[model samples]
Target: MNRTPEPELMQIPSQVRAYADADFSRSDSMVVKSLEKFLKKAGRTLNKNDLIFDMACGPGNIAERIAKNWPFVNVVGIDGSKEMLNEAENRLSLNLTKNLSYELIDINSIASGEIHFPFKADLLVSNSALHHFHDPYCFWGALKKLGKTKCIHIHRDLIRPASDEKAFELKEKHLSNSPEILKKDFYASLKASFTVDEVSQQLVDAGLSQLEVFQVDELYFEIIGCI
Candidate 1:
């Protein structure tokens, strides 16, 4: 099936609200678990000065988890959508999330030299970020600018199904209970996603072949490595 591109930012009020209200704890937890497992294997310990960026972070779900998991390290959730970030901030308490913050940034701007974030990332993580970019190179090019030398990465995204029938089956199988708007968006995202082979080729094209791409399950794929 040919890929269908969705808007990069979740700016619609109803759409953003639906996404923020949806329960993603199950899949979201998987991202944290994978990152922790990866770090343990590498035997790398995070410190106060370490900077962790959650790229294209929507509702800050994964970013919050990482910040709380490692309270000493600074965590910033960067997203292009104000509505999404607002929802993310609503869930954040200054008292509870002292080490956590949000940045309004269009990731593609970094690649174009329009936005220059002063600090480089020690660890950059993104969940459901890659498929949003119409041009995949925009995603990788911006990442290269943001990450420090040897920065650790863990990015997870839905894998495009082989056909529209397969995509619908996966959507209903996974999110049958979700709201109509949420379900619609989820279906669009699944259609917009890339396969493991395509993502692997993208990594090579981006000069990031050091990263490893593998299917995590039927619905998603993970990219992990140091760059």
Candidate 2:
């Protein structure tokens, strides 16, 4: 499948609402499990007062899970989509986590240094978000800004399949129960994703060669390391 980057923001109200209300528990549970397993492998632990920053946190699904796992840890989810953020805030309000917050920020602007986060991030994580950056440089630039010395960084996204047929097959296998909109979104994301070699080269170009890029599962690859 060729790389076809989707729009950075989910601008349509219905689309955003549909995505927010979609049941992603099956896939999201896999994300949280992978995060915990990899974080442990990196020899890090979430401190009681630690701050976690999740980029492109659509509807706060993954961020909510992180907050739940470590009740004391603070979580901040940043996204450019107002509708998505609104949905995230709504869901968060219904939860017990007072430490999880949502922010309306353009990640590209933040990556370009046009905007800056007020506080230093203890851990920076992004899941299934990297593929949305039409310009890979923006993604690398953002990583450079977030990946400070001693700050843990881990990013995971679907890997582009070798063939379009394979991409469709994977989507059917994984997202069979999902709504048509979400299934379409997943297919688009898979096509937009960078291959292993492409991502490795991106790391090298960004001076992030110290980080490790590895295929973590059948359909996903992760870029993980500390700065």
Candidate 3:
């Protein structure tokens, strides 16, 4: 299926509220666990000064997880939407987790050199972020700019279905109990996401073929490696 790009920022009030309130804990925890597993397999340990960037971190759920898991490492969650970052900051205030912060950034601007980010990441992670970019290269290009050499990557995103019918079926199957707004966004995201093969070619074109892309399940694919 040809990809249909969704809005890059989740700024709408109702949409943001639904997204922030949704229980994505199962999938969010998986991102952190997968990062730990990969880091161990790579024989790498994060130093106290090491930085982890969670790109397009919608509500900072995953960023909070990483900060809690690696209290010594500095973790920043970057997103374009102020509404989203507000949610993240509110959670941080309640959790009182150290070494974690949120930044209001339009990643495409970074990719376009319109904005300069101050920190480079030792570890860069994102969940369901790539599909937001209409041009996939922008996503990869921004990551290349943000990551230090040999930066570890753990990115998971919805996989585009073969057809709209399939996308609808998957959304209904997985999000049947979700709020209407959440389900609508999920369906749009499914349409926006890329196939594993397409993502692999994107990696190659971005001079990041060291990263491996593979389907992790019916709805998602993971990109993992040092890049």
Candidate 4:
């Protein structure tokens, strides 16, 4: 498998990040709803005792939701941006329970052994954040380390194509019916997203043969693994 050079660190603009934080906080009816349904269907039990890490966790939206749904599950939301982390901390506080927290950490650094969290997670999850990684391989390596029992990685991002026209078509059709928020998200995601073949090849290169990759929707991908 040929590895692509890691992309540069893609910083989320403050305005965009703020918009995302607010959108996630208020709009729980779409992907978040689907996510809960999916988790239930998968029979994932989040108990208070289990330690779960939300990698690239933005404003702790997913983390808070998970914590609320499974009051017993301990959740730690990790992000690289201090601003996002601060917002996440504030959000976590408002929805405070005993089992949730937030931390600021760079995903790539963690993957390269420059930084370490004290605990190994029972489950490592992220939403729409994987595409932001400057080094996707490092992200995968970190996931490999954290995914001890079950890995339920749900990413609702854009899907790129191997070729130019396919990519354009995907964007055109996908954006046509989407809401404004989704439109912005879709384009950004498309620019940042990887093709299924690309991600599959990466898994193979990473020696992660046990990983299962699925196209959940034209705009979403689900990657699952069992340690």
Candidate 5:
């Protein structure tokens, strides 16, 4: 099947509502669980006062988890979607950490050197957002500039399936209990995602060849390592 990237933002009311209201505890928990393992594999540790950046933080779901898990760390989520940020801010009241906040900025603009963030991040993370970029290198460019000093970075995204059958198989295997909206999104994301080799080449082109690109599951690949 040909790859089709979903819209960058869940702007439509129904789409936004469905996403924000859906229960993603299972999948989101997997991401939170993998965070520690990835960090450990990279030989990185977070401090009590570390500043964490969650790029393309749609609706702040993963950001919320990071903040809650690392209660003393300050978390800032950056996204270009106004609607998504609105939903994220609305949910902040339920957060266990007061340090979590969201910023409305075009992350893709980071490559253009047009946006200036107030702080350099100690840790950078993104969950399932890499496939959304029309130009994946734009994200790498942003990382090169923003994470220039030294930062622990990890990005996880779906891996493109070798065939449509494999895509649907993985979706059903992993998302059988998920809501219809999320199930659909998962399939689309798998189509849009890059293969491990493709992502490795992208890293090389971006001068980030040292980052480890590997398959984490049947349908997921992770780009992890500190720079």
Candidate 6:
């Protein structure tokens, strides 16, 4: 798959991490709900003792949910933004058990062998953050190194149809009932969303032929690969 720059590529500016973290905390519930559904559909099992990594885990919202839902499993949330990490730490403080933790790490630098984690993860997940990758292939390669047993789930906004008219029509038709927050999120996601073919091609290019790629809705796409 040819790497293409996302249309709405936006950086998480250093100054806004705290504010962004709060926003993420509020939206965490929705994210968890969506992810839980996807996890069930993927049918990938996680043992109570399994170690999971939440890459690009802004504010550790998903981490908190996973910890709550599967108390026996270990959940580590990683993000490049320190401010975001602080927010995540604060939010998860009350919920902290031995099984949950957070770290500030850049995905790109990790893939380039500039940094390393102490352990390999059993499952690596990212939500609405994959499109921000400047070089997704590098990230995929890093995930592969983490462990083949890992399952990756990315729930992000998808680009509408290739045709502008089709995209607009679909957006208008389906997004009418979406709340303001969701509408905003949906648009951003659509702008950053990749087509199923695009995602599959990424997997193929990364030599992940066994990967499973699918669309969950008009606005969301998923990729599940096991090494």
| lDDT score for candidate 2 against the true structure | 0.84
How high is the CA lDDT of each candidate model? 0.94, 0.84, 0.93, 0.66, 0.82, 0.65
Tens digits of per-residue lDDT, candidate 3, 1-227, equal 89888998888999999999999998899898889899889999999989999999999989999999999999999999999999999999999998999899899999999999988999999999999998889989999999998999999999999999999999899989999999999999999999999999999999999998888889888999997
Task: List candidate 5 stretches off by more than 4 Å.
Answer: 38-43, 177-179
Checking candidate 1 for backbone clashes, the offending pairs are none
* TM-score list, all predictions: 0.98, 0.92, 0.98, 0.77, 0.89, 0.73
Error of 5 at 98 (Å): 0.7
Q: In terms of lDDT, which candidate is stronger, 2 or 5?
A: 2
lDDT tens readout by residue for model 5, 1-227:
56667776667776677777877776677777777987777677777768989998888888999898888888999988898889899889665459899899898778788987768888788888888887888888887777746777778888898888989999899879877877887788888888888899999899888788889877677777777
| Higher-TM-score candidate of 2 and 5 | 2
On residues 174-220, what C-alpha lDDT tens digit does candidate 2 reach at each position?
Answer: 88988888888888889888899899998898888988899977788
2 against 3, candidate with superior TM-score: 3
Backbone clashes in model 5, listed as residue pairs? none
In model 3, which range of ten residues has the least summed lDDT? 212-221
Write candidate 6's Cα lDDT for 1-227 as tens digits.
22345422234453334235234443456556666666788786677767888877776677777778778888888788776777778776765566889887787777888887678887777676667675668767777766535455444435446655555566677667645554444444455556778777888898886867777666566665555
lDDT of 5: 0.82
Candidate number with the higher lDDT (3 or 6): 3
Error of 2 at 15 (Å): 2.0
C-alpha RMSD between model 6 and the true structure: 4.8
Question: Which parts of model 1 have CA positions greater than 4 angstroms off?
Answer: none
- For lDDT, the strongest prediction is 1
Model 3 misplaced regions, further than 4 Å: none
Candidate 6: which stretches are off by over 4 Å? 1-45, 148-189
Q: What C-alpha lDDT, on a 0 to 100 scale, does residue 84 get in candidate 5?
A: 85
